[model samples]
Target: MTTLTLNAALHLDDFSLEVDEQIPLQAITALFGASGAGKTTLLRIVSGLHREAKARIALNGEVWQDSDNGIFVPPHLRSAGYIFQDIRLFSHLTVAGNLEFGRRRAAAGDGPALEDVIRIFDLKSLLQRAPDSLSGGELQRVSIARALLRNPTLLLMDEPLSALDARRKSEILPYIEKLPERFGLPVLYVTHNVDEVARLASRIVLLSQGRVIAHGDATEVLARTDLKPLADHLDPGAVLEATVIEHRGGMATLGVGTQRLRVPGISVESGIDVRIRIQARDVALAIQQPQGLSIRNVLDARILKIEHYGEILAEVLLDVGGQQLRSSITREAAEELHLQQDIAVYALIKSVAIDVGLAG
Candidate 1:
């Protein structure tokens, strides 16, 4: 398996950052944390922009830095494409010119052809347009195209969508989701947005106070109550991978394991796999399957574990046809329903609660 290892420590004026971990290079690995948590600092360290005295950084056996060995490869020498929050396109250059500049700096036979990247990013029409004339979303597309033209082995994105408004973010997210599959490149994405992590991240690294608090599959990491304080503001949720089976009567049918779910209308065609996010609070548990109800989705599930967040709220983990589903409810409700491990129950999800915007 491809991996990136970093063992480093840095002391700032008010805080110290220490990172010692081996990150598996998946299609997209999210570096998630709030402000001042060293998310950007870690990205800088990986890109060789920042250095630590005892740092040792390596990617797939290639040593980029080793303080003990007296070896340090500069930022430009590393095959990494760094995209900042700001769209750093050259204002004086046309879109094509910027892309050409990246192609020129690429290592010999490193990445895709310029024309291919342009096509993938749908930048053909914007070739002659100047950066200043492009919209925020369009500028981001151009910047990403330029990075691809550079033939980077590892792509580092530091809150690439944070600068854009909601509409612009929605416009660029589909493109970002395609990067890993289109180029087979490993990406380290830094973001505080839980929705983005749910949509794009295959693996996640949770950071707090410059330390890695959790790292694992995106679903598992999000479900842990230990990270509740970190993500409570976002209304922590679970991500489910499902396939679109059919669409009719303004509703889309999705297959999750052996069970079927009806959700709000989705634009994608049938047979396309999608990732769905359901907030824990949006799910409700039932002791017996209901007969008449407005709710459309009711899946049979068995209780796996129950965790009390505080005196009033609790998070229940349920096994739904072999897939995990989380439901957050009042402690009184859980006790009234006699919720316990190995007990069978039903999960009721409202169709509107399913966030289709985060689907990918």
Candidate 2:
């Protein structure tokens, strides 16, 4: 399998950024951290925008930067497409002109055709319009289309949705989600939003104070109780891939690994796959399958592990038909219910607690 390796150290004023790890190039890896966590700096280093004394970076066995070997590739020669948060489109150029510039800069026989990129991003209609006249979402789409036209091997996106409103963010997210599939390119996405990480990333690299805290599968990283403090006020949860089985009467039925979940108010059509994030706090535990309950989702689960958070709350990991589900409850309730590893319990989840808009 192809991989991207990084081992570098940089000292700037009082802050130091040190990264030593290997990332798989097969999936979209999210470089996630809070502001000032050096997420963007790492991307810049990989793109050859930042240079350090002992830096070394290799992608798919090809060396881009090797300080010992006295090799350093410039940013423009690194074959990376970088999209900034501001959607940096040339104000003087029309959409078509900007795209042509990207195509002209590509290496011989590299990247996709201009017409294919336009059709994929739905940018054909905006070809003649200036960048200044486009909306935030439209500009972002154009920016991404231009990047694809460059035919880069790797794509770097730095908070591409941060400048847009909720509506605009929603509009551009679908395009971002399809980029990896529509074009075979490894993406290194930098963002502080856990929702975005959960929705789009296959792997995650968690950074804190210019250091790597954890890096692994997106679902596994989010379920870690030890890293909860760095999660930016978002509840730790599990992400499950499910298919919409049916939708009727404002409810959507989802099939997840032999279990069924009924979520309220999902607008997706049946048979389409969607990702659902279920926060641990939204789930409650029951000793027995209760009767006459208002909660619509109660699945038979087996306790996998228990970890205490602070003094009062405990996070319980459960296995629901091979899929991991988490629930956070008070220690008192956990003890009263006799929760332990391998014990069977019922997980109660309210349908309304699920926000369908976050599903992608």
Candidate 3:
């Protein structure tokens, strides 16, 4: 069992972060929560910047903090790369010079090849240009490249893209996606944006008020009804992969489990398997086939389960061609409609509710 044992107790005068739990830190672990939820605080402790009262933090086998045993690895020697919200690039240095700083500071002969990282991040053009001369996206790329050059065992990113605009975020997303593929290392990404977590996180850690409320697969924890209070105030949805068939006019045809769903606002080419998220509230169930509706996407499904959700609401679970879907409805509606498990029904959904995020 690959687990990160984190049993820490700290006090920041009037505020304390007391957490005792083990997080599976093998892949990208997303620290998700609202503001003042201690996500950044935990990151600070993990990076060895914040000292704890009684710390017993260990990653794999290396001892990061074990105050009882008199072992506490300092931040400098931790070999953990940290990327703050601001890129924090030195205005005096050029892109090439900034990236080389990590290589120079890295333990003797421990960093990755300098040439490869430069090419991988497409920093050749900005090599001679100073930090002040580069755009936001270019500076972020330079930030990431510098971290990679350090060849750290784990990379820590604290809302790295939060400071960038939409265009700039979109510009740097591809580089972020390729980092895992290129390095094959663990990353600790802290963010409040669900869209970023949906796109990148393999295992998500739900943090609330200086503690880990829940930690598991990105999809499972995000889909949980109980996590609604902790997660961002947004409708729950399931992430699915679909192959784009063709593009016609403003809509794109995609294949999803024995049916073709025409999605709107998709700007991708054919043969690409795009990831989609369909909200539960948008999905409606019917006892019998009731045609003649404005809704376009309809699927045959079997009732899987039903659970109580928000006030005056019940979430209906349906199995659609091996894919699970949830529909939020009123308690009175459920009892009146006599919704039961294994019952065949038709699930109606609109194309606009199908969100095109999280590329599978």
Q: TM-score order of candidates, best first?
A: 1, 2, 3
Clashes of each: 0, 1, 0
Better of 2 and 3 by lDDT: 2
Per-candidate TM-score against the hidden true structure = 0.69, 0.68, 0.66
User: Where in model 3 is the C-alpha error above 4 Å?
Assistant: 1-3, 52-54, 108-110, 235-360
- Give the lDDT of residue 72 in candidate 2: 98
Model 3 per-residue lDDT tens digits across residues 197-245: 8678888888777777788898777656455434344433354557788
Please give, for residues 190-236, the per-residue lDDT of candidate 1 as tens digits. 99988788779999999888889999998778756446434443532
**Residue-by-residue lDDT tens digits, candidate 2, 202-298:** 9999998888999999878876645643434353346556788998889888887778888876778888877666778778999888999988888
Kindly provide the TM-score of model 1 when superposed on the true structure, using C-alpha atoms.
Answer: 0.69
lDDT of 2 at 69: 86
Per-residue error for 23 in candidate 1, Å, reads 0.5
